[model samples]
Target: MCRWTRQDRQRSHPLNIQRDEYARRRRQLMRMAGEDAVLLVAAAPERIRNADATWPYRQDSDMHYLCGFPEPDSVLALLPGRKHGEVVLFCRERDPEHERWHGESIGTERAVELHGMDDAFPIDDIDDILPGMIEGRGRVYCHFGSEPEFDARLLGWMRRLRQLRGGGVVPKEFVALGHLLHDLRLYKSRGELKLMHASANIAAEAHLAAMRMATVGRHEYEVEAELMRTMRSRGAVAAFPPIVAGGVNACTMHYQANRAPLRDGDLLLVDAGAELDCYASDISRTFPINGRYNREQRALYELVLEAQLAAIDEVRPGRAFDAAHQMAVRVIAEGLCALGLLAGTADDVIADGSYKRFYPVKTGHWLGLDVHDVGDYRVDGEPRMLEPGMVVTVEPGIYIPPNDTTVAERWRGIGIRIEDDVAVTRSGNDVLTANVPKDAGEIEAWLKRGMS
Candidate 1:
């Protein structure tokens, strides 16, 4: 069962500088749109199993970025190029009857106060109120292909405006809001950094806990449960589904069944993270389930760990985004050649794309509010340069399938991945999740301590 501790409730770390930061982002987006107004909506309520059952609701990331409010059927409208032009939110009204079955609703009044909105109104009255807001506005800014329901509603509103063309009402243009917000979010604010750091710390601790709990005969799910418990105790949630693959299961990337029992000679690969204050931390670690790695497993693990460290060393401001990936690929290619897993020279294997037989996926990705954060790497359809305040994951792995005959029997089914959260800095990169024990010695020590 899920447990919520007293400390979770008592310790309140309300986000700081949230309002000002959000306002600045909205202003930038407004400037980019070159429009008089923009309209954005939060995620609508979703149906679950049946009409009687509904899924737990979470607000859209873009909406939360602007308003920091998590409620269903909410809207944010921004009017730009005008004095006193800012943000307004339309949300659910107060209803004591509905509150009885569900829970307390923030209501319109408190939403304006808490969310820093210029004005607030009941969401039910959107149709009546929106036309007035849209009137005389030349262009409307919103994300296309996001929400089908919202798309239908936007079309309906556009049709209504078209009907009023004879009545002296028209919209000259429709712009994609994604371009504006994506650009703004690419650079992390100080407030966002704090939350991301906290998330990294939490995820690091959870990984430590999983490492300590792992043992021969323990099911992978048991270790996953321990990690979940640790996260919950710290008032955090999983950034994604915890991947706890043991033995041959480790060869499968994105393996999350987590039901297999660990064996004496098997390796365990765990890819998990914690989400704190909506910011996410992604981390992965692989170790021996029996507290000591055999020679083959140790060699593979060290190579992968070395490749990860080499990649991380390349993370810095002004560097190409692909630098770390290239470094890791080179290291893995050389390692495979040394191990006789590849026949030809490292250069030949790498150039011919034969190295992908061992490492199929990219080394890592950007890590932030979402596990894979937004912001297209292309400016004008070109790779974006790395800059300060950007956070990313440096993970390098080598997976040897159980059925593969290229390597020795002992080396088969041994998969290893080492990941860490890195924040690009003015001088270099800071390892945000450094508190976790990652080195082979430190991991072994942690396991021993847990056994005692």
Candidate 2:
């Protein structure tokens, strides 16, 4: 078995920003939580992949956003006005034996020194110690339902406080932390944008690599393998399961079976992204397996490209969050009608939602730490207006399943989606993944480079 060396760890470190950035995030959260509020956030639990083995450990996005501490069985507590400390961390204690077998850990003391937590404690003591911090606060801010065990413990503490209400003032209210915290996270800081840009860059290279690998007679997994190799070597992992769908498989969104062999004149659709420094980049590109799109494929590809460009152009500031989706829908509906795929006027087809048969998904979603990152799409019952510093995806597509009888025989089994990571700016939007070619001719030329 291969073992990881120090160099391997060093290469994977995307912590280019100063440690104080995490401190700044905590400060922001504390300000939002208010002096009378107590905030509780838990680190993600390690998930078991199989018998006696674990999947790769990834920290919770909310927890990692507040503090860059990467470890399991940890939690963060924020008491904004406390004299002893405003921020506290409960984390794993250092045990030499455990470190030898599992991995080295950042113990409590260093958690304070290195990570800027005001105080720290062993996770074992949290059960005994945390409730006391919650005792007199007016409100508790935390994400309930995210961790069921933590939710039960929180409720238990509340019940205990209720039972002993006569003894002293007890925290009386529980509020969801996501309301304020996620809003804060929705807007990216300059450093955060830089990290996201880096992630997009890596994902773009991986997409190009996968494109080069998708030759006729090759299994879909071969392209996926090329992607994984590029990602792992560069210290990134897939933000989500990569969709390496070939031919008919492309018609199914979220397709996972990468066992099909690519055939000449067939198209491959890859929806994959990379996660770097906890920030994610999502990109999807459709190209030909034989280095060229066939006549029918090219017609559908150009239509989808037109719709995508229109949708992407709608990603500027002040536009409604749904504007991109609406724009894409209109474009797709109009194109389908023009191609004789639909019989009515574009207006009628879109008005009645008949176009959903071909385009069933929204144009895109917010992009960040999670591939489908968190942010309120609607605010106060209205579609939220876009603002600068927000990043979102502009993906527009059409999928015609192989067995569908509604469309022409040649048009079936064609799925084309063009997605790019876009960042809203004061003037307009920036396409972070623009380096990867999306044009039909551009893609064909790039694939030809591999053959040469």
Candidate 3:
């Protein structure tokens, strides 16, 4: 059987992301901020899942972007034109007992060597050390309000610096880190695209597994479990909670109970993705629980598929960011009118916002470190233009609520969505998650092939 073998896992988890990549990113951001500003980024704090157990620790995206350090109780400081060192890191010191309980941490010395940092120190001395480093800077750039405790500590340091007139200088302004950082993150580097492609391929495998296992009499959670097994075996985790909605349950956009039993003649919508090495890939596919779509289900599924393809075609360099969404909406609106679900013309339906009853959300969003990744959809009060290296999700869905009386009885309670991760290239675009079949006929054939 084709599965995620040990060799396959090793091949997918490559050493493409090197210290040089992180160093390059740091240098670029520092040059953008200039010599007058100091940038501070903190690692994500560990959260309690319940009484004593802690949830899995994930590093902050900005921190990961700046330096590929993966640890809690860590802080990064980028001081432009510093005489001693331009890049500094404060992280947990080596502790034998702590390492025994948890895991070995990237101590100061290792952090500097492995992550290309100029200097590293124990995090406990941040209060005594960091303020001195920041004293002379004119502006402090940090992602404030994200971690209130860290924000308070930063403010306290500034307050302390103000009190000490002998201190060299105090920053006069505080800037949101996202202003300069997010834009840098939007463009995927060669290393990032490699990881994202691996991520998408892993998720596609899991979706195929789910499709094969989702037979009538199977519970939704069972299908979800299969997806988890497939992704986890590949050293990846779900980007978000897998949405395994069947039949009428699919009408709710974010239905995540994942406990419903599969029924024959019902369409199953599975919106799930996998995160590989912190890079994410999102894909959504609707197929038949019994391995074949009926007449009514196939009709709507084809419409959603058409919309998704039309939207994906618009993901090209120099194209408007919203162009894909507009095309998808137009296609769906026309399809709904043809099916007698809407009364007016496609243009009139869109202009009057009458099509929202069936399709409420936008076509898609940015996809990366976070499932719904960063990067502004609009800039200067207008939709931004698509650029090479930008990755987006082209998802177009139609949901008909079970109780809505406007639709025919057969059409009601049917929901369909087709999503794929597309990366804009210099030539045109590439579908990262195309391994999983999206066409109705292809889906039926794939399901008939059984487990891989």
Candidate 4:
């Protein structure tokens, strides 16, 4: 077991996910894959932004989930019944020249020691070595089509194996890795939950800062800057590009160009989260730009908040994954109908799907290593049951397009969403991002304290 020590804490980031935990996950996955299979996981390719510039490298979530190795040009292999080694890693060799530009590469020997791999080799030698390991496997598991180059190489290895004289049995079947792997990822471990809570706390502070700085005449990006600064200062990064939409801009669900200026009486909707140690936290909050919501904004905002609360209540164990969405839709439909935004009763609005005009997206998604993390929402054509250790976001919103002209003008162009990270528990659920205020009155009071 890789135990965390005071020295380790001083030398590195506080979130110390033990090596044994990763090993346990690998063992669990291998057990599921069975002894006759060979599993291969490829690292994420670094992407280029423009000339000579590259976007920040993010490790493949699947690869990172298995081992905490943080380098590209790496491959993880699992041969369950292999006597020589069950876990293998092929990674970049140490190069002083490359180290001068980039950072040090954890060479093969260090990789074996640090990540507890049974064997390690240079990535450049994979083609020469890996095919021999794959020659006898009955089934091969990998993320098919994710990386064309990797897939092509894998296919080439298999073809060569088939042609070789007196070679051992080549893999007869190729399996999609996600179906098995993603299910494991859906359930969070203790370490993962800790990291997620930390991520949510960092994001909560950022959202609070955005609310405090959201005054009239401030540009959307300015508030976004505050969010970025807060997350970065806490040694975290944005889980996704921050969405700081103001007024009618909020009507657009995926609004990204946050350049609009804040105006008095218009609601500012900030949808953002922080990524800490690869675990992501997503939260969305809509507040008045001038520390006070107008009548229309207050009505929509309160309705969204009510819907979010109702949805969060359905996040307990045994509930279906979509239980929150159903509750949220019910509440939002009733509220909208009462507000005269829709002509029919709440039941009719839901049954006819008319409520989708305002509430387009789902109530939430599974939150973990990726913001919109892995795992199938359905199993056997039915909604999957919510289990303990499953983390989800309860985000309910209402977006009324500005030009609808279908109802009163006061209700148009007002967009409101209240979102929080919720973790299902044995008893009920825990709201990870509860540090931030969601109630309209609480938001006004929070802003007032900051202004004072």
For residue 374, give model 3's deviation from the true position in Å: 0.9
Clashes by residue pair, model 1: none
RMSD of each: 3.3, 2.7, 3.5, 2.7
Model 3 ranges with Cα > 4 A deviation? 1-16, 165-168
> Lowest lDDT 10-mer window, candidate 3?
4-13
Where does candidate 1 stray beyond 4 Å?
1-17, 47-51, 82-85, 165-168
Inter-residue clash pairs, candidate 4: none
Look at candidate 3 and give me any clashing residue pairs: none
Q: Compared with the true structure, what per-residue lDDT tens digits does model 4 show for residues 5-60?
A: 32244227657577899999999999999999999999998888999898998889
Q: How would the candidate models be sorted by TM-score, starting from the highest? A: 4, 3, 2, 1
- Per-residue lDDT tens digits for candidate 2, residues 388-407, read 99999999999997888988
- Cα lDDT, all candidates: 0.81, 0.88, 0.91, 0.91
Error of 2 at 178 (Å): 0.7
TM values, all candidates? 0.94, 0.96, 0.96, 0.97
Candidate number with the higher TM-score (2 or 4): 4
